[model samples]
Target: MRLGWYSDLNKQEKRTYWACFGGFTLDSMDSTIYALMMPVLMTVLALSKSDAGLLGSVSLIGSAIGGWGAGMLADRYGRIKVMQATVLWVATFTCMAGFCNGFWSFLPVRFLQGIGYGGEAVVGAVLISEAIKPALRGRVAASVQSGYAVGYAISLTVMPVVFAFLPEDIAWRAFFAIGLLPALLIWFIRRLVPESEAFQQVSKQSRKIDLRVIFGGEHRRITLISTILASGIFGAAYIMITWLPTYMRTVLNLPIASTSGYLAVNIIGSLIGPFVYGLISDYISRGRAFMLFLICQTLVVSVYMFAPVNMTVVLALGLLLGGFQGGLASGLPLAFSELYPTQIRANGAGFCTSFGRGFGSIMPAAVGFASTEMSLPVAMGIFAVSSYLIAFIAAMCLPNATGVDLSDHPASVVNEPSPTEAALKKTPAVFR
Candidate 1:
């Protein structure tokens, strides 16, 4: 099966896969670096827990807007063009964030940076899903999503050295400065990856992006269900991610070095989770695989939070939790993409994922508030358990769209011309 899948991909398709993988890797590193810096930033900026959570929430809000806007644009323009732009936009804003002098200054920079971060994910997922054949879609998309773990690992490994060597004030800034590295990916994408053929085929026939397309038609239920699904998954994920570093250092009284060591084990599990999820998803079905992982996530997170605090025990549970979370996430884009046809796939998938970020963004702040009443772990566990349960229900409600083809338009037709597309058509033939 592996050989068949590998042999089926042409040179262009293979390049597209690697491009999406690389783009997502850099995007994950740039975005997740903030989580690592949060503990330090809190001290340096005199930020209350609420303030820290607000920053995260605001950035996620920006991601939602960016995701929604980018998805619409990807439908009107081409995916590759919008994707390249998002990469540059995020890298530039992230570098600006490195220079911010205070809380107010950093807020806008991070928010702007999040726009590109959000858009890149949408375009990359849509591009790859459209480019590959349906039979390989589950495994390939999951593999691409695995880049998040790789990026997280890269940040986890580098952060310690950067912090240890540099002064505290400069160390945090330096981490943000490293966001500039992903700007180089634009050059790689420009040269290596082609636009999705699926998009190209439907380009002339495509209707302009309208809210009615996804939200007012037969697609509305799927859209609503998808958003709820994304929200639950994202909420649970953000709670763990936004607070894990702080929880380790503050509540557990772990030193910086020890925190890094524990996170390293978790990252290892994260790296392995996607492949396991991919195989399971390919063999069974996407929704079933997601449901299975969500169950594991609920269990592992409880153990990680409440179990005895021995170093070995913590490491083992952390690894398991990471695996469960990572595997659960791997199914999201596949399920979303499989549900929508090519014409609106970008919009549908992007909105669902981005909207999830918007809803999930609240958990960090909620956790911050809840921590004052109870221990951080208990607070996180409460939210996580609820979120996972909601996500499980949503997963069950969704259709089992494991290997559905997305290369064609939907059966229904509404080919209204977009202002954006009309403007694009006005460009000279040479420019086009």
Candidate 2:
């Protein structure tokens, strides 16, 4: 009975939903493995705090470029092909990092890995959004993004077990080597996933990649606002993930084991958040739901920064803050797809998300630098405040997407040009 029900659902939805979820899950797993190894790597390499931060920044820089590049490729080629290639690219580079002899060798390898990481989000999100039914798009997209939280939890659980038996020098290598496992998934993805029908229908009509289209009259304001909004979310998220453990250890005086436990709890909260927000967005307006989450995040993060240091309070705050912020992962993908037409959908989403990735690259180091002069809480408090402010601005500027079917929008507006339509107009068919 259960199998029958799932089969029915699968037929009704599309393979792209499962494909994006699986790809994102592996992407998250690969990224978190490196994050978990950061402290160990720092100690083994004798890296200065600044040098360690720079390594992270380089990866984000790589991802920003990858994101923009992948989006363009997806529009020119197809989403499935681009996604499969990105997974393979990251997995190959990540495995190579296992063989690095020193920090210098590892730095370049990690930057290359970032390129794959950057491309995954843009490709995966557009693929899923375009393939699924309009009514189910928000929920399904949220579920896909939620796969990241599950991947992070799996890394946290497995890393400790891997470390227990292995020495430090070899353990990092083992983690990197495990990253290669995702490469095998490319074969499955290639076999199972198909190009989006919507993309195919639209691409037949328009073959050109027009830069002027994105910055032209209708899209310019929305594009700029989306970029700013993504920057705020990415900046806050990267800084929190990178520096939160350090803050817990240095400021709260928690042992490494206890801090790991707190992080595990936070990740659990993150796992739940996207699904909850997805359901809520389906019932309420996406914009309203986003604004509510941001407002709650503003209050919760401030309390988290300045609250008294009891274990119970800290754990509660960590869970709430993590959950609220993680909701952004779900919201942005759906919002971006709805904001643009198919022709420019991939590019707009890619550019906005990647631009944010570039800005986000500096946030962790900025937090670390600020901490040297100001109190840890003070520096983090500023970050929390700025995030909420920007989120507020984004919410205000964002157009309401509630209950609108993207297919109803004009093909030229969204970038979907039918082959017949192109032939009628004597233009070449675009890549589908």
Candidate 3:
């Protein structure tokens, strides 16, 4: 197959990719500030560990709702509109979070921010998948998705510098207000991005949202397997990203600077992980690439959890864990896109991924609750091992997409209704 040159992408696809990437990167930056500032916030607000955990859980729940709703909206209104709306929503709320006077105010603001964050990922993934060529799609999507890690790295670098100069009370709020910067990207998106061609073709065929179809026949098996796989992977990811810094600080007894340094190293590994997996998935089978990463993740997470707490050992383990986990972001978009047809691609990916995200949200809180009773290392180890089991199940159940042409599948298999069936059945419910 002839690979299209980057220059060959019509202006619209290029614009869509960059806009989606920028939005997602900013979304990561906004969401990560809270994790980076968790310790400071806990002390400043005089909140308990459980309370801190609640804040994170509530945000995840909000994101779950946002992603679900945004997926449907993207299907109905077009990806560009949903993408623009979500970026504005998250940016405004994230800035508001910085100004909150207390827990009550912060909770609601963060919840709203979560909605924006959730919508960004779903919209971004769908936009990129639709715009890029099939052969290059995995790598391009992974590159766009890697913006999250880039944003995360920026937050880690900026936060300490800002805190060093300003008082904690003022500095933290300032960090959050920085989220507003992404809203500026909306102008670029408005100028450049086009409605996805795939989305446009599907929309002309059907405007209804029939979510129940996801559970009928062959799709039911794929849906269940995808949900379980996504839940386990995301659960592990959320726990790792949200609480690992605190774990480094409290459990390993590292200073703030040292913990940040370790996290920086870990994130570098994360930045590399996706690109590597994207390459492998392009040349090899997507399932094979995912399986390889899943095995590595299982091993890395176990070692990171149970290893003796020396600084060098911990840093090494953290790097490996970040790399393995990072590969999932690359694999998931390609895997899920291939699983369903173009019509319902956003909905299928959003529902399975966000729902899994919702289930995974429980892990961080569970880890926090377990920390009150058991050792942090033991609690983390349990979460790590559980993912291995989930990976095994996914490996067994997910279909191979090595030679599949997405366009050949009935759009309803993804999200579009068959023209013939339009006369016979009512539209499906949009599962937001």
Candidate 4:
């Protein structure tokens, strides 16, 4: 029997959802593969913690530029085309990283890979947001974002096997090599996903790529607020997500196997978080949902970093922290998608998320720098809480746009449909 959000979608809509989901899953896998290898890279390459952190930051910087560029290109060209290009771009560079023997060689490769990684995120989110009906938008988009955890889980699960079977020098290289396989996902995307009807309709009617559209008049306030919100969330998220493994190993003094187990438990929570946020946002309001998550996540992360616990207790705490913080990961994309019109939606969403990543990208290097003076946990805790607080404040000022329609122009802010609204009778309940 038909039920919930999936029941409302047609076959092509379903395909679009899965294709974006798969793309995001692979994107997460390829982007984070470097983090998984950092410890090994440090040992074999004789590098320092700061050097490793700088490598991650460089990629995020590239992501920022690529995201903004691709978003603009997607508006001018098409979302699907940009998505295909980004996947191939990252896949090729990631494989080349595996072949590099030193810092100078790997730096350029990772930076290029970062560009594709950032582009994929913005374009894929735009594709899914444009394709889904308004009512199902939150749940569907959040579900796709949840694929980050799925991809993280896949990498975490495979790391041990790859490291164990292969020789030490080549094992880390193999992980990067495995990232190239996502290039094949482009085939499924090309075959199964169709162009967004909303995008196609709007593209035919609009020609200008006015970057100023997001910066002036009514959009000005939203642009600032949304960027701040993105900054806080991505800032806190990167600090914790990128460093948790190292934190466990260096601070808590856990072995590699134990660290992987802890991260795996955290991944399970990450998987559950987005769905929770989506359901709450759909039923309540997006602003309230963001506020709730930011507050809860702040507390969870603070405790996870500050509280002293046994290994079993730490695992339980990791799960809680992961669910809350991971859930927060979906808020910005969902919020950004609802804030702008179809004509410039990709550009607005892309700039906000990528800009935030650009701002937050500083955290890894900042944390690494601080680790030289203070405990890793303490340095992370300070930055994380600060970022979350910023997001909480921004969420308070954000407009409640849970049911906003993307297919319409700015003047017409349609409310959820009633039974008497003839056009919406066949639409989902949450939308109408």
Candidate 5:
């Protein structure tokens, strides 16, 4: 019954794959719930566009912190435990967000909620990357992100139904309450997922919480480049993802059917994109795949933003916009893991994706502030094209790391300090 990449995976790998797939699906759902509700929140809470954008930006910031912290914790404690904890944390905080009355009150809850959101994706991607074979890694890891589109569809499908049955205020709250349901998956994870064999093979005594490992030597160059790469990747995608719903409804004055058509098409494209991108990357090169997607995305976004708005234009280009951009969302986790050794794999990968969000976290607010002057499409075009251009350049800079063997990574890199670090350690702790 198994076909394609699924045919290649054994039972243990399949188990890990499904576990990560479920976690990521929920993570995507919780993240989209905020975006879906931004318009409702604005009407009920008297929030300005900037305020709504701030809420989006803050959660990304929280996710940034959570991701980096989780990676470090995963390296020290264990991936499964930290992943379980993060899922529980996100579910709890997200439900609490439903109770808040204003932006100020919602701020802390949303931010706390984001921490879990960010941690889960980074850890899940890292976990899957560690568990799967190099030959199947791109196809498998990238396919997992298709769950994002699935999550978006779930939110889109459920939101209207919830709103149809309940009062506006109650519907949003009920939707938020639904967030807690992901917590139920933690039981399955605990029972089914085992610690990564790679982690077990490595000596526990050698592990420590040193931050410098990811920032020094061979890691330093890749970390800096990958962070910028991730920033570009996330910045490009999230800028549109965060604000598109609001733009369609508020700026375009889109009738409900038209808006839904565009979003539905876009979502479908996003669902299909990761698989195609993964197949392309596996056969060609990861760097080439990114370069191709980023270039095409820039052109597609440019057209999507600048071209005159009509049902025809929107319908024709909507799929390309979502497919081109959304597919690239997988690039960071798929590509970045090969850049580091096992010990700091999560730490490095986590920081790149998380802090990439940290860097990317700037745009929603920027678009919100810009909405005061320019058209949303204009603002989106300017920033989105810019983001893609940055990503294209980063893609150019990245080493071709496709189908790299993960099992062969040596532990010597983590234990060894670079020349600069060696000199600094010998000096006094404070004065040096």
Candidate 6:
């Protein structure tokens, strides 16, 4: 649990890390509940693969809107403010989703919740990305994402308890009602979390942070590539995660609650993966780190779906399955912040990642569509491996920014490491 990467952080940065880490963990927990409940929902609501896929896709589509709008608001108001609002927003809607009896009623609730989920992910990353020193940026910013695995592990542990005690139908509702717990984070944030200093500098200038800034001039390419990279990275993930529980239940011939052991291993691997990924990224470069994971994912997942292995072997493979998948997540959050300046930093990163969610959202449904023609495992494996391959190509195009200073100047989108280190040496020791 001890991380050398965090030792250098000041008190405010430490608080910021806890806030983002807590928020991202709960966000993963809340969002993951739907997937875990899929088997029951399908039976209760008379759903199909396509229906389940649509629900997953709908939340992500909502996230696309939420992430960008929250980013714009974060740019204007402040990161802490927007983050607080998002946490409250997600908690309210996630509880509401449990009340729905059918897909028609549940769809809109999921979308509204998606808005909060998407907003929390980007705003917190931006908050911490700006807080940490450049040398530790990739390691610190990306390691915060491991909170996703922590949240997922919580869900895996708690869901079996809910199912074991509650009535068959009501268990899912109790699972969702538990989601209301994340709202408690707001009090901690209001008391302890500080607004990003980078944002404070941007606010003092009173300049407008329009959406066009990211798409204009040299930034246009960065935005396009990051979006593509996000879609590929997250798309593959959504394909596997959105359908994983059901795949285990129906195809693997296990009960919904019974498969938790396998998933627990995967989640444990997920917890360990990002920390290792952060170290790799900080030392090697973000793009190279991504290339390594993406390639490994292609191989591991292929073996996961196709290898004629026994259950014991598959259980062990779950470790690698989760590790590579969890590791793939660090790139967008870290790179997006570095790809743009303070004026449009949140907006640009928001646009790329949010829209990446938008495009990636379809992959779950695509898996559903593909499943109609082939075995479900074949479909998921194809989509997963293909998505990573595409993302790997995008990684090749990424500009390295490992040591760049995150100045709030109108233009600090420079992606090279050395020039920014030299520039920082010439400036005041403190940002003021």
Return the TM-score for each candidate structure: 0.92, 0.90, 0.90, 0.92, 0.94, 0.93
Q: What digit string (tens of lDDT, one per residue) describes model 1 on residues 261-373?
A: 88888877877888788888888777678888999999888877776667788889888877887877767776777767667778888899889878888888899888889
lDDT of each: 0.80, 0.75, 0.76, 0.82, 0.82, 0.83
Q: Which stretches of candidate 2 lie over 4 Å from their true place?
A: 1-14, 101-103, 253-256, 408-432
Cα-lDDT of candidate 6:
0.83
Off by over 4 Å in 6: 1-3, 203-205, 408-432
- By summed lDDT, which 10 consecutive residues of candidate 1 come out lowest? 415-424
lDDT for model 5 comes to 0.82
Ranking by TM-score: 5, 6, 4, 1, 3, 2
Local lDDT at 237 for model 1:
87
Superior candidate under TM-score, 2 versus 5: 5
Off by over 4 Å in 5: 255-258, 410-412, 415-432
Residue 156 lDDT in candidate 3:
92
Report the alpha-carbon TM-score of model 4 versus the true structure: 0.92
Poorly placed runs, candidate 3 (over 4 Å): 1-12, 203-205, 407-432
lDDT of 2 by residue, 1-432 (tens): 464222445652556667788888888888877667777777787765566667777788888889888987887787888898999888888889889877799789988998998898888898877776677777778878888887787778877777788998898889788888977975496568778766776645474566667676557766787777777777778777776776787678876578789998888778888877887887875766777888888888788887666789889988887788778767786777776777777887888888778777787677767777888778877975796688667766666554356565425543344222322243222211
Model 1 alpha-carbon drift over 4 Å, by segment = 1-8, 408-432
lDDT for model 4, please.
0.82
Tens digit of per-residue lDDT, candidate 3, span 1-432: 535445656667678777877887788888998898888888888877787777887898888888878887787788888888898898899888888877888889888888888887887887787677777777777767778788889899888888899998899889988878878866566557667777776646575677775677546766677778778788878888878888888887888788889998888878878878877878766666777788888887887887666678877887787777888855775577666666667777777777877888888888888889988778877975786668656755566554344444434534344321321132122110
Position 139, candidate 6: lDDT: 78
> In model 4, what lDDT does residue 361 have?
87
Better of 3 and 6 by TM-score: 6
Question: Who is ahead in lDDT, 1 or 4?
Answer: 4
Task: At residue 230, give the lDDT of candidate 5.
Answer: 83
lDDT: which is higher, 1 or 2?
A: 1
